[model samples]
Target: MNVSNATIEDVLNRLTNQTKLYFQRDNNTISVTATSPSTAQASPGQNKTVSGLITDATGEPIIGANIVEKGTTNGTVTDVDGNFTLQVSGNAVLQVSYIGYLAQEINTTDRTTIDITLAEDTQALDEVIVVGYGTARRSDLTGSISSVQGADLTSRSTQMLSTALQGQVAGVQVTRNSGGPGAQGTIRIRGVTTLSNNDPLVIVDGVPSSLNDVIAADVETMTVLKDAASAAIYGSRAAAGVILITTKRAKDRQFSFDYNYEYGIDRPTTRPTNGDVIDWMNVQNEVKWNDGASDPYSQYSQETIGSWLTNHAVDPYHYPNTDWMNLLLKKSTSHEQHMLSVTGGTEKLRTKSTFNYQKGDGYYESKSYERIAGRVNNDYLVNDWLRTNIDLDFSKSNAISPSQINPISHAYLASPYYPVQWEDGRYADTKDGENPLAALRLGGTNRQNYYKFGGKAQIDLTPLEGLTLTAIYAPRFAFTKGKKFTRAVPLYYENGSMTYMAAHRTTNLEETRND
Candidate 1:
């Protein structure tokens, strides 16, 4: 059947004609009469059920609370299950009282179901201070080994494990000359350990390594070996102190998996300040002013300064004032990072695996980095006397550089009057000054590639009761390969660039056994 829309009057007429009336609820009070002497109906009571579960603020369950119908002296209490049920006489109130839980009172009405959630009393919920190593009553710790744990490392997309450690660990220092996945950070433990070799020894899963490829998400703990007792295990490499990095491995009898993702833009924390730029400009003017001229800016007469200011500052857009620094820096597009982890184990064998990917724009022009990595940590009980452990880590990365060219020379020595490009727009440069941008463009994406693997295995043989022999093996590798360029410019004209364009990689390995 076809139907047409109707106006308000038409809808009202149809409803009035077709609608039927029914019995209405009487505005009457419930009778207290039992109605019969043999089979009697009970009257409504004064109290209502105060049904609630008692729990601590941390969501932990609480048990054994006294619950009863108040004034009538009739009520039941919560059992070991932290739950209670009760019935009260007419108009009786209910009181819920518990030693560890706050006491609550409620009035009864014409209600069937009443539920309550009780909170822990102040005396029971008092704060308990924490002590590291093993929880002592905060008042017991005498030694100092600061603990740092809070912000989620998985949320931070730094490609290197060490990068995430910055500022979080006190007395432990991480220094990086530039940004990139494999750009090594000079790590020192509790200040410099030795006058000479200051770099602390890196230990992966309790085994020493000259180069350990660590994925940020896989790292669970970083402990600095400050004193002699901690350093004794490492021996020679420990002379400069020790850096122990522990990866997240599987726990026996439990199976777990997690996938975390984050997308964020990252750049320099502190850029070249305004004061730095001013100082640089002063140095440049002084360099030109030293050439027998009493005053600089003579090429553009002093009269031009007032006019330049009036025109530019009065209406900025109308008369442009060039700010090279602002033009050179901008917030690039947001970066994206994703990670997947799987860990599980049996009593005999435990295993862990993690995969991470990250990409972000670099601070300078034509710069960025992308990395993909996979790590597996495993433990196996070969026999009661024999056990083995292994951690395999591998990462591949590509870093995009602005130019392998001389950035400093182009930036510092380039003539302020000439600028980076002339009015003609062709790339401009001098014999002494070269644009770092050009050098970077020439080299393109010069990558610092890395392929790191750490393996550890041990054997334990019991020659007698409580007497055993152990053998261990570990190996590590790291490679930093890329092109660094410097053209014949104002800075590198003749004797200027001997130390420029120096790119070298360092690698190391370690192994041990005892009987």
Candidate 2:
């Protein structure tokens, strides 16, 4: 059209398809434009190629942005340049998305190219959190409540349920009575609230139970209701706070099994060392002289004292100055725990069962604990309007220790000059000496066995929308049997001979309790 020999009027006259082209004249040049291609007029049944670029607010390309046709899986991912091409219906709507960004939809009504920008999502502030007997959004909670997940319990080597929370939560104090095997600590939230009893209310799977019977392996979540407003639902029983425990439930799956085991050694943190025979005699002499009396130890000549000091180590049975602390206590004790669980579910029913066994030896001989526990939880959707749940748990524990006085206290109080055994293999019991090792080996014995069982059955009927009629019945039973046997022997003098007019007595006690 710009030929030097052809005039502008002549070129316009020779154009046969003027309606399909448009011309515009500028100060220095002429421009021509043609109609769009046939792909722009494609129908729903026809497929067309669409391409686009995606970016964030900072104008930087977003890698791996998903470009998909609405309601379908036909999609493509963006390249390093934030460009993507996909084959889709001409009238299709695209769903563009990326992680941590809000998704968007765009319509491709007569276009072949699209450009999208996504904004970051900020919906985590409204996340739902678990509360007492229900769940609420974080924004709706006004009282104090602390929650601990199952993962936190799995990493610790705690055998008792209450020991797992030691030092893990604020405002919660856990104190163990002693370093004895299977010792359970006391958990007090926000300090003591009552003068008589400061123990918090422990609820396991909606059933009131002792914390010792609840195995740590079966717990799914532990929530503490700390404030009065949050614990008001429990009434006067929750004056010291409330501990809600929820056990693991069966998931939607076929059959699954899990096993866990732990084994470790236990030892006392400190051992007391007392003075030997020579030191004991010298102290006894000093005490007598200080009391305005002559030395009572003068009855034993200098030669006897020198012999005791020389032969105490070589002939421990004859002239023994034994270290009762080390002789009566072991270097270290051992403990073992095992847990097994099975879970299964179907379209209308789900069930879970677990079994746990634990055994621990105390630092002293003849002191130990053994326990076995099992639990079963099941739920069934009988029909569209009827549902039911069943839960059953049983535990049996046996604890054995000295009935009268603990061995550690006896060892510290007993005189060090007393030998553990005489030369004739008889327990030594002099006029002024009490062999603590004899009390631990042939003294009083106490054994206690406790059995607990709890069962719950619940029925729920949904008669209308947002309304449910429920009924629950839970029964708990416990039996404790304790046996005590004390051996009373005649008092002996310097030799292994009973005193004149002395008699031996034996007593046996059996106790049974039910609740």
Candidate 3:
């Protein structure tokens, strides 16, 4: 056991000689194999040198094909001529593998020369990816682009298409700007490229649009152009990056209808912790004493603090350790989404329609978001050389929240000693005029409403064998309306005394814009 000065080989020899074990050394490590009296004298299997030519199903040579011995680390790759020579034990299985091809296992039991033919993996290589202005097979594209299928986007419960795009691609960063309901994340491709706006140009079905305007369920494919060369078609608008989105269209002679519903809960994972009344008063007194002050910094005296600690359990309404976070926020907010899609068409005429509705509540009370969107796409084959397509999309959304004060920030600043409400159902006064609960319940309302309508028509004419002429017309209209109403709130002390009015005035403001 104490072989500090012994070499590895010497230790291994000692271990092998003392027990019925055999050691095999490989790359600075020794592996032990047990040996018994019945098979201890058996001879090792003989290794045979096998040479083979690997080819695809088309009878073409496939260079760099991997030839690995089954259940072992012995492997070799084919040379330029698709010829590989590997030494393997008798009765060994030769596993042949290549990219974009199905692997095959050949049993080289009694043969010295073997030939393998690997079939093309059509499912892996035949995926059609949408690129700029057109589509290409996955194996044919050589650009800096990443594709996400619609099935993958709708696999999870997400309110925004941008939210579902997070972690779906490489070199892309999706950061959320806020934690409010139905919030969309800001995406940055290959890091920040400009100071003003780094948002990628979003193109939906050949028309410039917003990511939030497209429903996740309606997406057929989402492709991101990471490099400048791949996004060169958009000119300066694609200086940051580009995101091409293609919505689903009608299939040939197929009629299908689908309805999907999702429900999710949102809760804050972390919250700021503030000291209780006793701890606050103690810290205040300590700060004043350290500052060489004659009296405590806080208005409450030591006797009052002691009385609060003693009677807070029985009389919580008067001397309470109020948790502003819990008072301002609910335990958990919920969101729900519903989608309905109808697709029916023939070989000449095709049509697809989708409708989506979503409602979500923010972590804070009295904060909510709602949206409804619909899309319709139609394709017409007028003749052998003429084809027409039409697309229409519309959406409306409303976001409501408190306008007077930020409830979250105010919650962190509000003192814990103050009670949310007095025993007589009156709002309690805080050192600061802002009470998060009061601001949420009685403060002004900030409502933002947005409406969007987009229409596109395209005609394709083929006059020659390989010549085609195309014309497209797209028009988009958007309307935004904002309304805010501020109301005054009065606070009362425990003894029914009046404090300063919180807002002190009433104001109504409305704004509308068309684009």
Candidate 4:
């Protein structure tokens, strides 16, 4: 109380006991300001060292748990003993996370030591799964069933829905029927059951369907019933297995618009390796000599072989050492997908709609696939006792491939000495009359077009508690059109003259199916 004889420092210290204040002296001019409790406890820009131990809910030390300062990249991981020390700024927050465990955040204000216990993430086990004719929680199901989310399927960037299921579900083996664009894979659930068809029966939105008729982006969840007990509802039809596909639907009283686009490049994992023309000529001569020929270079003279080796580099077009695989197949093919979704409605009526377009190029020329698909789902609640639902989906796809022969096989067998094209841009002849480049570029196309339209409608009436009557009507229509055309490809000499017709043949076929 008697500050007249005390210095400024002593006076301030005595006054701080009764009321917290901040004082600043500028060359003997003293200024004081009132301060809050929090400001008096910690100063700005001050840092302190904090240490913590992380453990699981059962009090077991959790090794390798990550601890990070909130809003900063400064972070550290727990040691083998589950202990971590970190330097953090005043009033800093620490975020602790680990796999299969819930994350925790702790404030380090007025504290030097902290301990955390993480809880197990039971979200996956508590998820609701669609089974046979109804839905049940995963923990409640005893049968062998696996579920894959729609997001997981789309992340793989596969064109066919069957291809997206590869390696995602346990005990489910998916093998591609072909490498061409828009090709579907064979899905064998629990291995082969019969000698005939091993294809699993696919059900989309409670209706029998094909995987090709569904789009990955439009799926909500995929459930596979592996054992007979889980798929007994379908009887003998589920002999192989049963796959249930649920499409996305609108939520009540929510409005959202989403657009997604993906672009990717597909490259062959391996390519055929061929030697240069000189090596090929030497091998040919050796083969003839081994076959008891008097002159090894009878067909390919030594002088001609030497001329090719000398001029091949200078005049590659005429005396070319062609790599037929590289010439026929592109380095990389491109594929893209576009999706637009709209979801909006009131409490009484909800609706969801999606439109998708996908285009992909094959590794070989004259090979590609394109598809356009659209879906609409609507739910209406007439009253608490009555409800109605409707779903509509349509897709059109076109696949173009080389007709008649397999160009990839031909490329492996074709000679490396022949030029892909002569100086005059005419196809050159091969030893086997199978010029892969000519077949890829000049060959006719085999085109297949598929169109599908499907609709599902349902009505429900509830007359009493826990008692409801339901009726459903589902109809699907599919049409497929295929056309194959093959024509002759002429082989020309180096001087731009037609040497001979390279096994040319004319064939035309067209087929159409509706179901």
Candidate 5:
């Protein structure tokens, strides 16, 4: 160390510490080697802090903002104060967004709180679709199945499934036979099948079934499996595709109920007219060859026939009890339907049950239908990983007396002079008139009874998040029994001889089961 003349290095050494070094080489200038406090500021590294007063494009403070990091699991929704703090990493991009505003991204390199204004994302995600056994984005589906969800059915005003599908599905047609309750609905998809009977197979929960299987309000969805690939799995009876019905499931903590109603008028078809041309030629032609030779109608004198045409107009035995056609017909018929359902579940058990009633009156004599149907579905969530389910469907339907007619030939065989009369004061049974009212009364009264009871149960073990193991059992029974009685009605032999009359009874039953 030079002490003479106060050399630069000697003076600098006294002032600078070991940590700070200051030196002069040729006694010309001094150099300093040390960290500048301004350049050595502390950093959070991967962690980021964003601080900015959110505001609208007009700079007014936005009350609440939601900020999320682009690709990681970090996200923070803004508070009511419209301010937010986001902690993110170095390589991370901070996403600032809100319900009404568009999203904005800023790199967290060296900034603290970045005040940002966001624009709304007008193009939101499309509707979420519920597909078979799973939910899909819709665009990714390559199959021919169509899913009809609960929300879609809830918006309709019909009581039955048949009414709901009308005018709703392309290539699917639903025809309601009449306006009365218990009226049957016919459905045809695409067109009639040719190779075999083309009727579609219906599956409820996994078992074959139909609209008769449950109330509309108790149903969750109806899926149409249209193509071979989706339907082939059901086999022999599935040529016409498949209708899969999913019944409402029990909720874990709430009891729910619903009701639906529809009221309308029954419009009918017009009746026949043209009352004049009875003439004489047509009746004569229809006479049986053996009897035609005898001119059976001419057997009645001209005066008698003239009297029948004016005053005894509607009779076969000098009585006005016959119009043949009118006796065999009916006027307008009407109906009503009501349905009730309740569904709910607890942590350990759940249930869904429904009751439905329908009544229909036909425009024809004694033609009517009445149905009473009930259903019960129960599920027990046995434990965290096990569950059991049960489904029951029962119904009774009956068709009332309606008119019977052979409109084609009734106009030809009856003689205007011969009157319609019965020994019992009821319209008599004549070869021509046939006494339609008598046939309904004494010819044979028919009573038919139909009953069906069906049920299914399954146990499920869900060991994984989305996988389930299932076992099922099913049993069903149906019966139709008819009783008829016809007292001594005449049976004529070919030789014009009368033979003995007869009475009979018919009955049948069907029962099925699966395990």
Candidate 6:
């Protein structure tokens, strides 16, 4: 067993002379078979199974390694213990591959059991990464840059690209300014640089565009330009930083279709839940007494205080203690999104088309946002000398909000002792008090619609090898329309009936902006 100087011939001769065994040469190894004085085996079309363990050079199990027959789709991946079971025809060759490892092809002739060790592919370590104007190998980069793939973006439950970017990159700060649905998050690269708008310049497919216009599912990659050296090409607008977003495109001469739907709910982390009616009355009385007010019960009688504590809906609307926050704000708001895309190509032409729709409700009633967007991109090669590209995108968005006051702020500040409405179904009002519930009921709506459209065309003429002519033209248009209407609301009440004595006022406004 310890014969170190023995040759292959000696070993084979000893094995043949000692036992009824025969050896044959595999690619780089030895295969052993028993010598039987009987009939030969059957044909190669019969079904058989091949099982083994795949590992690395260090003999550690390589989970999820792909094992398949040579020229077909029959394949299986390794299990947790690097064990694989593959069913194939007799004497089939097995091809194995894993990420970051070199692939191997093993011959399965007259052998059903074997182990494989794949060497690490060192060349992949210097893989090329996309940059601002082009690409560079990771080892050849001198500036700071971060890249994220589209698959990572689509996995998040977000309506806009900005919100999905949170925590996805280093040296980037992303924050949601408010808890309003469909609100875009604020992003600062390498911190703020100025007192004015410190937003980074966003470049979509080589044109300046807003993140709201680009759907998360339509993005192919996002690259952040962090340092001055990496952003200098963009001038003043790039003082903070720059973001380059590339949309998806057809990669080969095959057709593909994708559909994705996401539905979720958003709720406020904390709501303004002050004390109940009885607790509120008691605390107000204590405050009045502490401030040297003589008559603590001057505002209401003991009977009224007991009625408030009992919460008897006797008159239904006359004497009520309304939980304004609960009445005005919903516990959770619904959100939904849908996206569809088609991609196909030939060697001469390639096309990708996408459509996306989104709708979400705000925390407050009657507050919501809706949007629909579509994009189409095409590229054509008119022989090897000339090529052309076309990209078109359009989006329409509508938002609705309360005209007068934000419901959340009113819910926290207004008193909750008064009823939202009177017995005759009239809006409740007080002379000196502002009813949050009344404000919600009487306030009008402000609506705004945004229309964005952009298109670009480029042609390349490769007349010579190192010198070529290029022509490009891009046009963008945006229009916004807003409408607001307000009506005079009773300010306050006297006695049991409403009694605010003010002149009725009405106003109508319409605004339009274009760029």
Clashes of each: 21, 0, 0, 0, 24, 4
Best by TM-score: 3
Report the lDDT tens digits of candidate 5 across residue range 23-43.
Answer: 434457665646543343235
Q: How many times do residue backbones clash in model 6? A: 4
Q: Which pairs, if any, clash in model 4? A: none
Off by over 4 Å in 5: 1-137, 147-167, 174-186, 215-217, 256-267, 274-309, 312-325, 382-384, 401-424, 430-433, 487-515
Residue 371's lDDT in candidate 6: 93
- Give candidate 2 misplaced runs (Cα > 4 Å): 1-129, 285-308, 313-318, 383-385, 430-433, 463-466, 499-505
TM-scores for the candidates: 0.56, 0.70, 0.78, 0.77, 0.57, 0.73
Better of 5 and 6 by TM-score: 6
Residue-wise C-alpha lDDT for candidate 3, range 1-515, written one tens digit per residue = 66888878888888888885877676888767796423433223877788989988788899999999999999999999899999888778999999888988998875668988899899867888888858888889787889899999998677889989999999999999787887899999999998878999999988888998899999998999888875568888888889999999998898999998889987779766767778877887888778887786455687888788678889888678887777776778899999999999998999999999999988787689999999999999999899999999999999998877777786677778778888778887876565667767876788889999999999999999767798989999988888887777777876788765456344456565554
Instruction: Give me the runs in candidate 1 sitting further than 4 Å from their true place.
Output: 1-157, 179-184, 210-212, 267-299, 306-322, 332-334, 406-416, 419-425, 430-433, 436-445, 460-469, 483-515
> What is the alpha-carbon lDDT for the whole of candidate 4?
0.85
Per-prediction CA RMSD (Å): 15.3, 14.1, 11.9, 6.9, 19.4, 9.4
In terms of lDDT, model 6 sits at 0.80
Give the Cα lDDT of each candidate. Answer: 0.56, 0.78, 0.84, 0.85, 0.60, 0.80
Between candidates 1 and 3, the one scoring higher on TM-score is 3
- What lDDT does candidate 1 reach at residue 120? 61
RMSD in angstroms between candidate 2 and the native structure over all alpha carbons: 14.1
Cα deviation in Å at residue 317, candidate 1?
Answer: 17
Any idea what lDDT model 5 has? 0.60
**Best-performing candidate as measured by lDDT:** 4
Ranking by TM-score: 3, 4, 6, 2, 5, 1
- Which stretch of 10 consecutive residues in model 5 shows the poorest summed lDDT? 500-509
lDDT: which is higher, 1 or 6? 6
Better candidate by lDDT, 1 or 4:
4
